[model samples]
Target chain A: MDTWEKLDIGLVMTVLGMGIVFLVLIFLSSLLGFFERLFGTRRSPAAQEPKPAAPAAAEEKPPPLPRPPSKPAPEPAPAAAAPAALRPAVVAAVMAAVSAYLQAEALALEPPVKRLPDDLSFWGRAARLDQMMARRL
Target chain B: MSIGESILRFLETMGFAAMTWQQAVMIGVACILIYLALKKGFEPLLLLPIGFGVLLGNLPLAGLMAPPVYETVIDPRTGQAVQEMKEVGGLIYYLYQGIKLGIYPPLIFLGVGAMTDFGPLIANPRSLLLGAAAQFGIFTTFIGALLLDFLPGISFSPQEAASIGIIGGADGPTAIYLTARLAPHLLGPVAVAAYSYMALVPLIQPPIMKLLTTKKEREVVMEELREVSRTERIVFPIVVTAAVSLILPAAAPLVGMLMLGNLLREAVSMQPILNRLLKTAQNELINIVTILLGVSVGATASGPLFLNPRTLGIILLGVFAFAVGTAGGVLLGKIMYRTSGGKVNPLIGSAGVSAVPMAARVSQTVGQQYNPSNFLLMHAMGPNVAGVIGSAVAAGVLLSMLG
Candidate 1:
């Protein structure tokens, strides 16, 4: 503050000085706007990137929502077929979880796919990227 | 002139040494700043108040701006000065006190913590790296500031420079809190720089984001996130609060509030509490602080304090810092895209500036333009949220190094 007070110019003068600078900046910004319209390069195809237009559509794709994977078709299907009294609570639990996701508006990236089950055979002889991903970008 | 008249004349002349025209013009400029802040959505919350505060603080004999820290007051009904205006401090004075003593900002961090969502960041730990990368801009600005001795009326020590550098994070509360502690004098410039550039993020980020990432890169879509289990969600806030508090005691207040808010939201049993907190976060707290923060921050821009070449230098350096942060985010995004075989939308990289979901929203908005099916918000949230932690960590480093 002592140094500030010792400065030769008064505060009002300093403010006035900056006000001029602000005006110049505003004016220059407007001038650039005019020139940009006059000489800016035209938008080209390169202006936008290409994606896997049709091929991405073909991807069997992950299910779009967070769905619990289909109840296993394996013979353990009786567990899903359990008695009605026990099933009601299980069904309510599932509904609540699903509702929570919906309420949170959890954005599923395009389609949510269940990651394939873990298996040494699947891992050892994995299908090509296109076979697994379904969509090609 | 008579002796009394002559004394009056001499004083008036001395006062007029400032020139009424210049003062009036300064006041006009202050009003214009106020108008831009209010009329333009350019940080209207803080800018409007700050601009008005600047105008009011500088006006002579308006007697409103900075009432003497303590002043005489009268109670007409009681016919007494019953309640002395005991240096309770004028609004801007109190605000400046908050900044000077570093009071409100840390509390603000607590509120911010309560409002934040760390899940996205937790889901994608790599966003933390991008967030950290963006912090490079803060230090870069510090180096740029070192070179700014060539500018007029600006010479910051290393600590002061570091305080100013955190403005690159584009987190106003943290910047103010940090500067208030490390370099109280530069708080005026640093706060101005942080808030002004934050308002300019839309204008500043897109160009750098475009320049750094290819069109293909922008269109990359991230895989869906797994269900972050309820217990996993609940543990997030508790663990982070403990981790951050134990690790960086300075960041505890902010992290605690933020995580506490998330805890409220995730606890699942506290719907009423969540409703109350969510409403306050969205409305009351934001509105009140925004009014105070904006104006008070603006008040720092009093004609003398703000009307310097250093302030100008800070503004320019601020843009550079923002650009650097954007560049870092997008570039790291490109790297992630490559490593993941184009599974990451580099646009999410731009969310690394920690504008609290705004930058993340921008990434989501822009990505949808490139690919209608793209859902980048949660992905962007990773870096967007990490940017908050990143800035807090940066603040901790500055405090420890220069506290």
Candidate 2:
């Protein structure tokens, strides 16, 4: 076929192709809309059953609900109190352990604690010690 | 033979001795594609395999894409001549049969259906219009490709024009499927153009979107979509398959497979056993098909056939198709915006071009730039998935007319 003839065919195809595409999608869109109306209304009553109770619960429990938020503040306080109550016992145990270490030191049963370099930070010292230990291993 | 003769024969058999300038150029093209896929991250899953396939196809004397050889043999007992297999074809040659026979594209669609969620589309069915609008790019580009025939050294027949125009659909599988049927010769350039443009969606769409809509329309924060029920999701794919297949029986392969995959995914909620099939379709099956399809399509792009004025025209027209499609969607969106009393964001309309989450994300990103609190991702997804159906339908229309 000649170029012009092909062009004419092309023009027709362009219209047909776009027309069919639009028609198909529009058909699908409308079908979906129909489904929405069909299924949507059937489920609405089940969905709406909860609506009345939600507002009634809200009205009756508004004061009670605010207390829950404030209740969390004091909840953490009891947790803190338990730790505070254990402090004296912890200190006494630590003191007893220190005395036992002192007695051993007096008897020359152990070496004195090694002083770490002042220039190194705790993390840096820990890293350096880790490297040294690794090398030794 | 003497040692010197033996050495000379070995050297002659080397790939270096057989290499042509065309083959070298193809190697360079392959490298460039590889670089784009790796460094620039342009559709790496497909492009990377395609680039390597191009490399393998162009390697001197590799014969990786060679067809099977047949030989005539005499049957001594019967004193008759018969054809026998002399040599097997190359790996890619066999794998390419899937494409040539038009099998892979629909399989890929199956995977896409499994991965996709149609709830957003069901929630806002109006998005289907945007999907249809975006298909305007395909037909417009078909005319543009035909018009290119008027130029010197660039002629496209109606079938070739149709294949070239499908690149505007911005869908890789649909483009491949249509091109394989309509214009197999144009598959390489068309696939490359379609994928490259799909990867470039962010770049191509924003300008058209900005030009079409005012800032207020872009900034329009859309309302949240209503919840879609399990029953609607289950019914959607079945209804679509029946409707589309009835209307355009030609599109049944692609649209039917896509809806089937969607049904497997959606119906799994009730059956639970179908989840295994859904998982396979979504992941393993699709991944295998993608690799095979990518390599075979790339192998078709030999240096001599690919580097031509027609390819250049196809590349140019591809961008035109994408731009026109985006504009079409946005224009329809602007209409929806007016009709809906500014409830619809025009930006989401561009997602109708069917690049999936990428196009939808672009809508969200652009919408957010205008209004930070605005979220258009879910809203845009409605049209994004709808575009897949629209493009498949458009492809069916073209195939019925041209095939």
lDDT score at residue A129, model 1, on the 0-100 scale: 49
Candidate 1 structure quality by residue, lDDT tens digits, B1-403 = 6999998877765634444554565677677766777778777766677677667666654434465554567777877764455554565776667666665676566567656766666555567766766666776776666656656687666667777778888898888878778877666667767877888787888778778877778787677654344555576667666766775687665566667767776764545657777667546776676667666665655566666677777778888888888887888788878898878888888898888777887787677667766768888888887787777766765675567
Question: Residue B243 of candidate 2: its Cα lDDT?
Answer: 99
Kept native contacts, as fractions per model, are 0.00, 0.66
Share of the reference A-B contacts seen in candidate 2: 0.66
Q: Could you tally the backbone clashes for each prediction?
A: 14, 0
**DockQ, Cα level, model 1:** 0.02
CA-lDDT, candidates in order: 0.66, 0.87
TM-score for all predictions?
A: 0.66, 0.82
Candidate 1 Cα outliers beyond 4 Å, as residue runs: A1-137, B1-26, B62-89
The stretch of ten residues in a row with the least summed lDDT in candidate 1 chain B is B61-70
Worst 10 contiguous positions by lDDT, candidate 2 chain A: A71-80
Candidate 2: tens digits of C-alpha lDDT, residues B213-306: 9999999977667888888998899999999999999899999999999999999999999999999999999999999999999988888888
Candidate 2 segments exceeding 4 Å error:
A41-137, B76-81
